[model samples]
Target: MSQQRIGDRYELVEELSHGGMGDVWRGYDAVLDRPVAVKLVRQQSVTSPELAEEFAKRFRREARITARIQHSGVPQVYDAVLDDSLERLFLVMELVDGVPLSAYLRNGRPLPVAWAAAVVAQVATVLSYAHDVPAIHRDLKPGNILVARDGTVKVLDFGIAAILRTDVTKLTATGTPIGTYQYMAPEQVRGGRITPQTDLYALGCVLHELLSGRLLFTADSEYAIMFQHVNAAPQPLRELRADVPPPLEELVLHLLRKAPEARPADVQEVYERLRPYLPPPGSEPAPNEAGPDGVPDPTGLFRNPYAPRSRARAEQRPPAGEGQPAAQPVPAPVPGALREEIKEAYAHADALLDEERFAQAAEVLGGVVERAARALGPESRQVLELRTHRAAIQLLGGDYRSALPEFDSLADAYGRTAGPGSEQARACRAQAARCRAELGQVTEALAALEDLLALVRSVDGDVSEEAVELRRDIGMLLLAQGRTIESRHILEPLYDDLCVVFGPDDELTVEIAEALALIRLGLDASSP
Candidate 1:
C-alpha cells in the first residue's frame, strides 16, 4: 500500500488528498502513457463484507455509466477495480490540471456573467446527458468543477452517482444528508426522492457563487446548511453581483426554489433558456435569461409555470388542403358510454396541462394517445398525435423543443399514412425544415429535405412521377444555397424525364422546365 502500483498498470506516484470515504492519488498509467487520478476507498467505507460487495458494485456502476458519456467538460473514467486484499477499491480517471472553480472565483474580479453561464451550460449539458440515461451527478459544487488553463471547464465526481436503474439501492443514504448541504435540493435535504432537478439546484448555488465571488448560502454547521436548503432561498444574485444580467438573476432564483417542482424541470431547460442569451451556444446571451415581470424565465418561454395557465395559444389550424383532417361524422346511435369516456380523457388531459401538471398530463394523455393511435391506426391524422396544446405543454415542461422533432417524426409518419406526394406529407417535411432552420441547425435542416427525398424514393419506385417531383424540391434548396452544379444535375434529368412523362404542358413539367431555363439564363449571362 506504500507508494505502489495497484491492479497492475497504475503506478501511484503521490497521495493527492483524503476524505471520509477514500484517499485520492496522482498516478501514471504506463499502458496509456498518461497521468490519472486514482481514488481508493478507505478501509472504513469498505470494511464490512456486505458493504465491500456494495462498494465494488457502486464503484463499477460509476465507471460503467461515466464511460458511455463523452463530454469535453467531464473527466473520463479509465478503470475500476478491487485491490487483491479486498481492503481497498480504486478507480482511475483522467488527471485534470486546472484550478477548481472556487479558486478561479476567488480572484478579486468576479467571473463574467457569460463565462459563468458558459461553464454552467457545459455542466448542464453533461448533467442533461446523464439525466437522459437516468443518472444524477448527486454532488455538484464549484470545487468539483475544474477550470483548465485553456478556459475549458470539466465537471468532476460521480462518486455518489445515482443511476435510475430501479433496483433501489440508488439514493445516497445518510440519515440527514449527502452532497454539500448548501447546494442540496430541498428533497435531497429532506431525505425524499431525488431527481435530475436536484443536481440543477446544486448548479444554481455554484453559479451564484461564481458570479458574486461569494457563497450563495452558508451556515456554521452542516445541520444548519441542510435546514437552510430545505426551507430557504439564497439571496438573489443581483443583490450580490449588481451587474448580473436580469434574466440570469431570475434563473438562479428559480433554481433556488425551495420546492423542486417550482424549478426548471431539467438541466436542459435551465441551459436552453439561458443558451439563447449566449452567443455561439458557448457564450453569453444579450439581455440575459429574463421574463415578463422582467425577471428571468429560465423556465424558458415554452415551459409553462406552476400557476394555472389562464390563456393558452389558440390552436393553429393546419394549412388549408394540408393535413387538415376531416372532422369525423357523428355516427347515428353512437353509444353515450364510449363518447363520455373519450370526452372525459381529453378534458382531463387538458385540465392537467392548464394546471401545469405535466407529468400527470403525460400519464393521462399518454394513455389517450396510445389508445387513440391504436384505435385510429398510426397513420391516421386523427390518431393520438402530439398536436393541440400537448406540444406546447411538452415545450413548457422543458422536455427540449417539442415541436421540432415531432414535426419531423410526424412528417415521416404522415408520409406513411398519406402517400409521399400527398399535400400532408409535403407540409410536414416543410414544417420540420422550417423549425430546423429557425433553430439554427442549417445542416440538419438540409438533412430533413434529404429525408423527404428518401421517403419519396421509397414510395415512388425509380423512374416514377413522384420521384422526379421530390428531386425538384431537393434541387430548389440546393440551387438557393449556391450548389448549382448538384442542383442542375438533379433538375436536368427530372426535366428530361418530365418532358416525356407529362409533356411540356403539365404543371410539374413546366416547373422543372422553368427552373432549367432560369439556370441556363444565369449561366449564359455570367459567361464572358
Candidate 2:
C-alpha cells in the first residue's frame, strides 16, 4: 500500500518479504526522510485475545532485548508500535541488503571447507557476544543468516524466536517447541532449561548442514527428528565427506554433543576451535577460496584483519602557528572585487546547512573562510570558526575525504590555542571522529568518540548537552559498526535524558528512538 502510512511517518513502499509472523514492507519515514522496514504482526495469527496481549508484551521485551546485543552482525532496531486497537503490532527497522544463506543451499552441494568454516566462525563470533547478553537464539538456521555483499555475515531474527515463541505453542497448544525441528537442540526437545549451550547446539547443526549439504537428523516425521536430536548419535562428518578435516569434524561433533554440558563450553570455545580452519591474517586464498557466487570471502576478517594498522608518525607542529594570534588577518580580494559582510554570509551558510544543503553550505562557508582568513589572519578565531563550520557541512554532505583533513587541522588548531581540554578543541575532535565514521574507519571513530565523550563528561559534567550528544553519536556509530548491544546501552539512557531535558518532541529524542528501533530490527541506517 504505497499510500498507507504507519505511525504517521512511515509510508509503506513495497512488501520485502512475508512469513508466518508478519509481512515486512519497505517503508519510508516521512519525518526522518529515510527508508525503513515495517513488520506488521498478523492479527489473525493471534488465535485468541489472551494470546494477543501476551504476544504484545513478549514482542516489546524481545525488541528491547534484541537492541541490547552489541555485535555488528545484528541489525539496528528503529521503532515498535502497538496500535491502540491492539489488533496490529508493528516493528520499524533498518532495511538490510543481502542474500539469504538459504540461497547457498539450493544446489545441495557441500560448501568449500574454508567457506563453510568462515560462515560458522562469523556466526559463532556473533553468538559469543550475544550469549554474553544472555539472550538465546532458539532458532538458528540457513534462512536466518544473510551474507551481505561485503562478506559480512549478518544474523537475522536475533530475538524473533522469542517474539513468535507462542506461534508454535498456539498451533498445538500442547507441547510443540517454538524452534524449527531440524535445528532444535536436544534440551529444547526435552523442554529443559534453555541456556547459551542451546545456541551452540544449533550452530553445530547449521555447521554440519553447511559442510554436508544435509540436515544432521532426517526422518519421515518431525517427532522422529526430535527423537534423533535427543537420543540418536550424529553420523561422522569425515565418513560423509572426504574433504572434511579431522579437527573440524571433531569440532562439529563436539558442538553436536547430546548434552548441553557436553557441548563445547560456549560460543567462545566454538570460535577458537574453528580458528584453525579460518584464513590467516593478510592471506590470499586460492581460487577455490572464493565462493561460486563470487561473494568476497567472509574469512577475510580473520585472514587480513580489517583493523587499521599504525602508521609511522613524524613530530608535528601547531596548526594555529607557534602561539595564538591576537588579531585577524586582512581579507583577500576577489577577482571581481565583490565584498560581502562576514556575518551575513555566515548566516546564509547556516541557513543552508539547516536545510541540509550541505555542499552549498560548505561552498558558501569556504569563500567566507578564505576572505575571513586573509582579512583576519589564518589563525584568527573568526577564520577558525568558519573553517570548522565548513568542515562540519562537508562532513554532513558525505564528503569524508574533504572533511577528515579539515577537521583534523581544526582539532590541532583548537588544541594549540584553546588547550586540548577546551570546549572548542573537544568539539573539533568530535567532528573528526564523525568524519572517521563517514569514511568507514569504524574502529578509529569509536575510539575517538569514546575519548572525546570521556573528556566532555569530565569537563562539562554528565548532564551537559555536549556530553549527551556525544553519547548519542557514540551509540549511533556503534550501531553502524554492528555493535548493537553496546549502542543500546548508551542510547537507551541517552534517550531517557533527552526526553527529560528537551522533551519527546526534540530532534535528538526522536533520533535516539529511531536508532533503538533500527537496532531491534537488525539493521543499520546510519549512513549519509
Candidate 3:
C-alpha cells in the first residue's frame, strides 16, 4: 500500500502490525521531525450513519481519556484525528522501542520467577494509575505489553478495546471474542460489566503464562476458550512449575477468581502481594536469574528504581576543582599485540555504533578502556581520548547521568595534562554542561555553559566556532526558561558575530536571526 499521511502531519512510513481494530504504522511526525506510532482504526461495517457518527465520537473521547493515564508505562498519546467522513480515524502516539512480552515466551521456557513478578508488579503500577482514571484496559495480555531495552514495562493500546467494544455482543462475526480469549475475564466473556477487576483477571492470565510457559486454558476453538474462562477453574501455577512460589501462585488464583469481587480489592493489593518477589532496591539479579537470551531484564527497574547509569569502573574518581593534584605521568608504551587489540576494539565499537547499537558499542569500549587506562595512566592522552569516546557514546545512548560525571572527570584530567586553556578541556566541560541540560539541571547547566563560554572567549575570541556554539546554547537555554529578554541579548550579539564571520546566508546566521526575530515579537507582545 502507498504511504499515507494522517491529519496532514503524521506520515505513515510502513505498516508495523495490524489487529482486529486497526493497523499500526511506523510513522513520522513532519512538524516535530520525530518518529511516532500511527494507528488507523478500521472502518467498521455499521448498519446506519448514526452508528458510525457515534463510533467516531466515542473514539475521540476514549483517546482523550487514554492520554490522561499519566504513567511512564503507557506510550504517550500525542493526537487523535477523525476525518469528516467518520470512516478514517487515527491515533498518533510515542514510538516505543521495545520487544513485546510475547517474544519472551521462547519455546515455552518459563520466565524467571523474579522476572515474572517484576513484569506483573510494573503492570500493576500502571494499572493503578489507569484505574484511577477509571480506564479499564479491557484487554491486557502479553501481546500488548512491551519490555523496553532499559527494562521498563510499557503498556500499549490502553483504550482501544473500549472504543471497539461499543456494542453488547461479546463475539465478533468470526466467532472470536472482542479481546484475546486466552486473557479475557469471565465478565468480558459473558458480555457483562467490565471494571478494574477485569484487568486484574487478565493480568493473572499473563502472570500464569509467564510462570507456567502455557496459557491458563487451551482449546480447539475461541468459543471453548471463552467457555473455560467463564466456567473452568484455572490450573494452579505450581502444578505446571514446581519452582513457582506458593504466595505468587495464590495471588494468581486470587486474581483469577470467577467473580470480580472475589479477586483482590485493587491493583495496589495485587502489587503488594507481588512485592515480596520483586527485586529490592539497589539489588542485582543473581546469575541464575538471568532472563531469556536477548531479552532485557524486567527486574532492573525494581532493583535500582530511579538509579543513575552505573559507572563501568567500580571506584569513583575525585572531583575536578582548584588545588587538584597534578596529572600522573604516562606509563610505558603498550606492547604491539595489545596496541593492535585496542585498535580492533575501537574498530568493533565503531561498527556497532554505525548500526545504532549504542549500548553494545558503549559496552565494547568500556571493556577495553580500563585495561588501556591501566597500561597508560588514566591521565594519559590516549586514555583520555578513549574515555571521551565512550562517554560520547553513552550520551548518544541517552545515559546522561553516566556521561555527566565522565565528562567532568575528563575535563579535569585534560586541564591538568594539556593545560586549562586547551581545546580538549573546554570541549569536555561543554559536553558536561550539555549532559546537565539533558538531565533537567537547567540552572546548573546554564551556569556551567556561561562559565565555559567565558573561558572559550578568553582563549579563542567571540567569533570562534566553539564560542559561537556556546553563545547559541546559552541563548536557547534562556529562551527555553522563558527569559526572553536575556535570550534576545545573547542572540543579538551572536547574530551580528555570525553575519560577520560566516555571512548572512549561512545556516547558523539564519537560525540565530530567526530566533532573534521570534524573541523580538514575544518581547513586543509582552511590553506595557
lDDT of 2: 0.78
TM-score of each: 0.50, 0.58, 0.63
RMSD values for the candidates in order, in angstroms, are 24.6, 18.1, 11.7
TM-score of model 3 vs. true structure: 0.63
The number of the candidate with the highest TM-score is: 3
Candidate 3 per-residue lDDT over residues 208-252, each given as its tens digit: 999999889999988888889988999998888898889989999
Q: If ranked by lDDT, best first, what sequence of candidates would result?
A: 3, 2, 1
Error of 2 at 33 (Å): 1.9
Clashes of each: 8, 34, 0
Write candidate 2's Cα lDDT for 260-345 as tens digits.
99888888888888888888877788886666564545666677677565342422645322355323335444434323456666
Model 1 spans with C-alpha error above 4 angstroms:
19-21, 43-47, 107-109, 161-176, 276-528
For candidate 2, the 10 contiguous residues with the lowest summed lDDT are 312-321
Top candidate on lDDT is 3
The residue pairs found clashing in candidate 3 are: none
Q: What is the per-residue lDDT of model 1 for residues 1-528, given as tens digits with 9 covering 90 to 100?
A: 124888877778678777644677888664654568998755444557786677667667767887767776678888887776666678788888766666665554556665667678767877877787666777788767776644456787775434212222212434434566667787876566778788888988888876777777677977676777776657887777778878889998888887778889888789877775444522233565331231122222123323343442333434323443334433244246534655676687676567565644544544456555555455554442434335445445544344666655665555455544565656566555655555556575677567656666676764565456457767877777778778898898887777787788999888878888888888888899
Residue 421 lDDT in candidate 3: 59
